[model samples]
Target chain A: MLELLVSGFAAIFTDPLAISMVFLGVMVGIIFGALPGLTTVAGLSMFLPVTYVMVSHVGLSMLTAIYIGGTSGGLISAILLNMPGTPASIATTFDGAPMAKKGEAGKALGIAVFASLVGTLVGVGVMIFASPVLARLTLKFGPWEYFTVTFFALTLIASLTGKSVIKGLLSALFGMMFATIGLSPVDGTPRYTFGSLQLTSGFHLLVVLVGLYAIREVLLTASSKQEPIKVLKYKMKGLGFGLHDMAGNWINLIRSSLVGLGIGILPGIGGSTSNIIAYSVAKNSSKHPEKYGTGIPDGIIASEASNNGSIGGAMIPLLTLGIPGDGATAILLGGFMLHGMQPGPLLFQQNGDVVYSIFAAMVLGIIFMAVLMWSGMRMFVQVLKVPNHILIPLIVVLCSIGAYALGNRVFDMWGLLLFGFVGLMMAKFKIPAPPFILGFILEYQLELNLRRGLEYSNGNFWDVFTRPISGTFLALTILSMVVTIINNHKASVRELKEKKEGTA
Target chain B: MNSDTKREVQIGIFFLVLATAYIIGTFGISTFTPFGNRGLDSRSIPQLIGLLVIILSIAHIAQVLLREKQVKALLENEQEADTLVCDEDEVACIQPVKGTIIERLDRVFSIKLLLSFVYLTLYIAAYQPVGFIISSTGFLIAESLLLVKKEERKRWRTFIILFSIGASVLIYFIFTRYLTLFLPSGILG
Candidate 1:
């Protein structure tokens, strides 16, 4: 393992082109991450096809770098503008904006960047060791286990859906229904093509991702009142604060990192929610919970740490089971498939060097994210000075080009507009996008495994209960759904009681 | 009666129509049965999805209606204590006045938003004919100018134009040269 790790490091450094690509990918990712409404998924999807021309290691390395940089980039806008550049950074805004307002923007940024680096390292450590063991264990999984796991992952859509369970179900169902458009898994029958030759390919996940996220954001900007952001100025003295501040929060850092890693490894949830959950955990566990969301470094650290840590956590399932934990990793799954490299136990066994190289790239990417963000702090803050009018137009044009470049078809661009409208309407009606994306990604796997499992069992659906792993996962799915519903009911009742008491 | 409830009803109705269309469309999908039909067919999952969608839409509409009724009752109770009194001959004074068409149009479609949609639509329509570079540059400059408040448009014009051209060329070269993905050339090529 050490030798492979060393060789992976050598491969990236020895090749100047690979190193440069990593740097470029990180820069582009930061730009995407720093921009509101442009997420890690959008960045990954836009760049997925571009990596098709490069070698497997180089291409995958660049994509990983982008993911790392994009995940970390959201801090810039979150701290400066109170607008989360990415959904993963939403928790950052709770304290980050307050910190900036208090003229501690530099301190907040410093803590966020440092915590992000530490969280990423911890996650990478956990991923490097845990993935191999988990993959080996999962190798024993049969069709029944696979189906059950997928079913369990689908239940996680509830966790991602914020407030409305029904809306979440609808979104997931919509995604699943859309995924069935092209061809049936078992019978190879063309379904819902509507006689168009282009429909046979169905919609590219890139098209859906970019349309729902990037394009819809553009339309939203155009539709809304344009307001220039107010930028804050701050003076820093060497990473904004002393080492003493970080030393005091070591426990918080460690705890949040672990939270991020655990959440990230679970399919269907990733950095997007990890930061919020981590921040809540930190607040609940803190000596002074009231100090949170009031320009505190602890909140910043927890938010930044877990989100960045989840990056590493997300890679584990992708590399081990070929199951993406979220939208971004789903695109990473596409990146692997595009390179003709299937990511699973077989890939790890046959291509140990490349797998290790990806691990090395992630470590290097984290370092680059830290160093670049620290040094470029001044320049990144200037990004906030750029008016939305100028920024939105540029993003829209790039998004248009990116959509068209996929399959080199005008139809994809049209699909971008269609999904853009769909996404806008979904947002207007408070329907979440994450569930829809998860549903789309898991639909093929769910149907294929279900049919295959039943076929193997000679059409006996009751056999799922006989397999321990399958039964455990199925039970867990039911348990999770029940718990979520009960919790929501309890919270609603509490809210009502409070309101009544206030009125009285 | 509230805008939020109106929006919810509209969304629910839209989904209802969409679900109906999806279910009807699934009838065209034929299962390859010559090899022996086994397991779930292609149409089954979609039909199930359609049914679920219909059920959910109806439930959401009902929820919205119930909420709207409660809100209306509360609003009526609030207004009862502050009811306005007028003479019997004051019909014009008592009646609620509606805004002019121009005022309503301005509220619904502001100049900035309307122009934004127009430029974007034109850009998309011109993309295949006039080519990517030209259409994109034009869209960028116009949208940028339109986005800014009128007083600042004059100052932003040069910067917006220069930046738009530079960005358009840079993007075109990056995608075409480095990535080897061809943007539509059209009249320009």
Candidate 2:
């Protein structure tokens, strides 16, 4: 292990192209992430197709760099424009926007950059050391264990249910139904084809993503009479923070980063939730909690660090267990398959150098993100000055092109339009789209594991509960759902009390 | 036509109809299956989903009804408060009456919906015969022209068209050459 680490460091230093690709990837990722409506997933997806032409190690390096950089770059717009460049940065706006208003935009950005670097390093350290052990443990998991893990992931929809649990579950069920449109996974029997040749191929994932997030946002923004709100014009002054400030918040930064890494290692829990969790933890622990949302550097640091840290944390499962942590990692998994490399317990044994190269690239990417964000803050801020009418139309065109480009099929363009309309209707009805996305991604695994587990158990239902790992995971799933319900109920009661008090 | 009430009614009706249609569709599709399987078959999942949708729709209708009752109760309490005091007509009359159902329906079918219908129709019509590049460019140009603020519309028209055309062409080349993806040429092929 020591030798592998040493050789990995040496390989990265020796390969000039690897270093350059990492730098380039970070730059592209920052640009994409700093632009609202262009998420880390889109950036990774757009760049993923390019990996087909490159060597596996170099390609993986580039993808990792983009993932790391994109997660960190979101803070730029959140601080400068009060618009979250990515959903993960939503909590950053609470303090980042205020800090910008108070003319401490530079300090806020500096803190975000430094914290991101620290978080990413911590996450990478954990991943590099812990992935092998996790992979070995995962090797013991049987079909029942796989099914239970997937079931646990699907139950995360409860956490995302904003106000209506039934509506959220319905949305997830709808997604699962959509997944059943194509041929049956186990039997190859055609289902829900509706007599169209295109239906046989199933709905494209890219179309669903673009429609559910990008196109829907575009149409909603276009329909509304309200113009985009510009918060403050940001000015860059210092790129450095004092040691006193860093030392003062060191514990908070470490704690938040650990929280981020833990959450990211869990399938289906993405950087967005990590950001919110980190922000809440920081606020709860702060002596001056009231100053958090009023614009404090600590809030900015906590959110940015946690989200960036998620990049490395998410990679752990993807590289070692063949299970993606979130949508972006799922796409990365696709890229790995495209390169004829299967990512599972066997991956390290088959391609140790490739794994080491990815680690090296991630470290380099973190440094690149800090440097590029500090220097390129002005460029990202300028992007916010563009008028919405012009900006939205451009996004629409890009989305159309991206959808069409996926399969080079005109049918996919139609698919994009169809999903866009569905997305618009969903927005009108206030149904969240993430659960749908999660369901779609998990459908194949869920079905496959269930069938395999049943077959393995000879149709005995007790097998699912009898297995220790499956039972434990099932218990945890139930616990999580109960906790979510209690939390929501408490929040609603408090809200109702406050409302009544105000009325009286 | 109170907008909120109309919206709720329309949604309720749509879900009810959808549930019915899905059930019928699943049953019809299942009947056509050649093989007789007692176990989980192609039709099972869809049928299950359809049933779940029906149950959920019924629950939604009930919730909507309960919400309407609560809202009416609140409104009645407010009205009673108003009746207890002799209010000045000038200040009291400033509050607008809730819109009628017909007015809400009209709003639902306003110019925006008409424009969206037109846009989609134009897209489908132009997609095949005009090819991907030409149709997409045209769509972008027209959409931009329609969306531009009135004062800046004329000045930006030329720039918008040129930019749209450039973008379309660039995307065409990248997708075709680099990615090995094809776009529809329609009659232009």
For all candidates in order, state the fraction of native interface contacts they contain: 0.51, 0.23
DockQ, candidate no. 1? 0.31
For all candidates, the clash counts are 0, 2
Q: What does chain B score (TM) in every candidate?
A: 0.77, 0.70
lDDT of 2 at A235: 61
Worst 10 residues of 2 chain A by lDDT: A220-229
Over A1-504, each residue of candidate 2 has an lDDT whose tens digit, in order, gives 667777877787788988888888888788767777667766765566556557888888888888888888788888887888887899889999898888888788888888888889989889988887777787788878878877787676536544655566566666777777777666666667888887887887667766665565565555544345565765665674566657658888988888889889876577888999999999999988999899887888788878877877888977776767776777677667657787877787788878887888888888888888888777666765666556556566566655655665667667766777777676666666666766676676677677667666665768888789999999988898788778866875686566456555
Sequence-dependent TM-score of model 2:
0.84
lDDT of 2 by residue, B16-103 (tens): 6766776676664543333333234456656776787678767766766775665555454443222121111111111223587655
Candidate 1 ranges beyond 4 A from true positions:
A1-4, A36-38, A45-49, A97-103, A341-353, B1-6, B62-118
TM-score of each: 0.90, 0.84
Error of 1 at A420 (Å): 0.8
